[model samples]
Target: MISKQYRLDELAKQVQGEPVGQSDLKLKRLASLENASSDDIAFVNADKFLDLARSSKAGALIVTEQLRAQLQDVHQNFIVVANPYLAFAILTHTFERKHEQRGIESSAYIHPSAMISDSAYIGHFVCIGENCVVGDDTVILSHTKVDDGVEIGKQCFIDSHVTLTGECTLADRVRIHANTVIGGEGFGFAPYQGKWNRIAQLGSVRIGNDVRIGSNCSVDRGALDDTVIEDGVIIDNLVQIAHNVKVGANTAMAAKCGVAGSTVIGKNCVFAGAVGVVGHINIADNVTVTGMSMVTKSISEAGSYSSGTPMLETAQWKRAAIRFKQLADVPLTQFAKKLDHIQAQIESLESTFKLRK
Candidate 1:
């Protein structure tokens, strides 16, 4: 819960929403409708939760137009907006715990050649490499490694145990969660006399502004050109982006999705959990891939794509599998010959009937 309280009217102004009922009512914190109290604010975005919202004890509510109309007979304090969930998300920051950073810790190691801003916080046991640059108000948490020539921008948050390899750049407001390795070596090899020779990765990673990368993710460096993640891309935990892959703006990839090397994913694309895309393919803009789908080829148009069969009973599936296996054994030439014989017999019978008539 937040220590500070605000009137319903003040919150309405903050969210640019229309206020109804008692605008002077006080709200302390943000909560779900089912868990809200008299001092809390709750939001209603869908019809399934309307009953829960109606019975909630919240002093103030953020609601959509449909929900606002449904509660017109009731005298509950509410703020109506186009997107109640977005307003609720904005309000969450008011109750979130603020981390107060103390400038560079004594236990941190900083190279004399590195340029660090005065407003930046360098946590204990952190290592900053030579010629590396840390921007203003940026926080490098404990045990994080900043390799040589890495450039991190202002207002960025690098969580604990992150490894930023040499020459990689992060723009402002980029948030990287713990244990994520950026600019790691790409998986490239050349076959030489039945043995594989590793190709050295020479390029780095370039991440744009407002990108959020979740924990334990690995983004590989390119073999020649840099791997680029555009602005406003959100990647969930355990996602793997291969070398030289380009992810377009505002694309959101869920956990465990893997994109093979040199693939170009378009803008506003959504990849659900466990979706796998093959290498060197191009996916068009506004595409949404459902969970556990395998993309073996390029998607040229903007649409929702899915693959793989749905679940079925073992007995039913076995029967279907037998028929599928037998389909290859059918002979087209013999079947056509049998059909021709039946047609000849029918023609002979028709001629005899016509003569008798």
Candidate 2:
């Protein structure tokens, strides 16, 4: 572990939380409330989880102002903050374990024509192909392959088992997690003589600075135009970006989200987990798509959009699904006939009153 320690007072100011008990106490690691021991620190953001804090074995707790008074007699040290969860995230770097430095392994292969900066580190079994450029202070971890004509910028970290295919370009400070395959051939097939003919992916992927791509994600290269990701875009694990997609700056997408071919995503958008956007659609700027939503059409409005059946009990969902299936069979004409019968009865009563008058 990194073993770096931070004073509780210093962290309290950063997170804007009130400090209860000893503010001078040093925290070495962060842990969940249920799993925290005497040496570890934990945070509680939700009031519903206050009961867990009362019985927690942790030495210190990070909490909001409202929750601090409730834990006054809990005997454990507490740090009251504005955003406990965000505070915990801010402090996560302090307790993060440092990686040990190792020299490049002997098994790694580097092409004679490849231009790797002297300051860059190449790990075990890494393969750098012909005419590739690895920039200064970049780290290519074990089993990574940088194909020919690829250009990786300064201070990027390419994790293990990543494949950067030919003609790909990553700008500065790009961090790619393990098993991510960039610049792969897009899913394109043409039918000829009742069989699928593969279309050659001749274009490339151009990613801007400070983009962080998660593990096991696949970003396909374009078919005729570049698949571009602008600066500060963050993508989660298992995402698939199809050919010729342009994702704008600072857009964040959660895990398992798929953007189809030729879709253009605007700046500062947020897509929840498992959201799927159809091909050739355009999403406006600052749009937020909720989890499991299927975007079959273009979103011209810059607002949050969501669609899907919510979670229900198995029996309840089954019953609802069955009712939904039978809805089309219900006759509107029958309902209109019943309404006409009621109207005739009301009119007859009115005529009987007029005759009495």
Each model's TM-score?
0.88, 0.81
lDDT of 1 by residue, 172-265 (tens): 9999999999999999999999999999999899999999999999999999999999999999999999999999999999999999999999
Superposition error at 353 for model 2 (Å): 12
List per-prediction Cα lDDT, in the order shown. Answer: 0.92, 0.90
Q: Which candidate is the best by lDDT?
A: 1
Candidate 2 achieves a global lDDT of 0.90
Clashing pairs in 1: none
Candidate 1's C-alpha runs over 4 A off are 72-75, 318-357
Candidate 2: segments with Cα more than 4 A from true spot: 1-4, 9-23, 75-80, 100-103, 192-195, 312-357
